[model samples]
Target: MMRRERLRTSESPDGRKVATWRLVRSGARILRVQDRADASPAYRWPGREPLPLGAPGLVLFDELAPPDLATVREAFPGCLDLWNAVREDFWHALLDTSDLPASGTKG
Candidate 1:
């Protein structure tokens, strides 16, 4: 299945960059995005599983760093088009997904 994403970057307290690619579906429902870092932890990370975080969109981020305009353009060739489409499609996707039951229990 195909999912969507957008880039995010921020500065940490120590002046280092905190970069991530946010996961969003058509309706702008943000799930989760892993950090843009390389790691060799004891367990496999989110994107390393049988199905990666963003599915078909996984290839858009092969670089080991956060995405900039240049990187996005180079990766997708027409990044603006995809961005605009995401803008247009986000709400509808959310409404469609809202039909499903919420995941966690309220107790």
Candidate 2:
């Protein structure tokens, strides 16, 4: 089946470290990730809609800066792409191996 890897930011200029969890599941599997820290009072709401598949990555900021979509895009290119690519690859592999679906469908 699919193999998942968790990734975190090495460092940020503001000293905030972003944490992410990656899931590699069958194409048929659905995964979701959330950022509880973002929901806390310390962050400025970005008004951005939650990702269609939910956030597969969680980021923790040390301060109350508004959400920077651009910075997020630049910082976690691989992680963002992994959400779909990894899942597709794993799903195909699993399908090739067996008829059963993935057990861990949610992130």
lDDT for 32 (candidate 1): 22
Query: Which lDDT values do the candidates have, in the order given?
Result: 0.35, 0.35
What lDDT tens digits, residue by residue, belong to model 1 across residues 29-81? 22222222323222123244434344332233333343433344344442344
- Please give each candidate's TM-score: 0.26, 0.21
lDDT of 2 by residue, 64-106 (tens): 2322333554544644544444344444454564444367654
Measured by TM-score, how close is model 2 to the native structure?
0.21
What is the lDDT for 40 in model 2?
Answer: 27
Tell me the deviation in Å of residue 69 in model 1.
11
Top TM-score model? 1
TM-score of model number 1: 0.26
Clashing pairs in 1: 26-90, 27-90, 27-93, 27-94
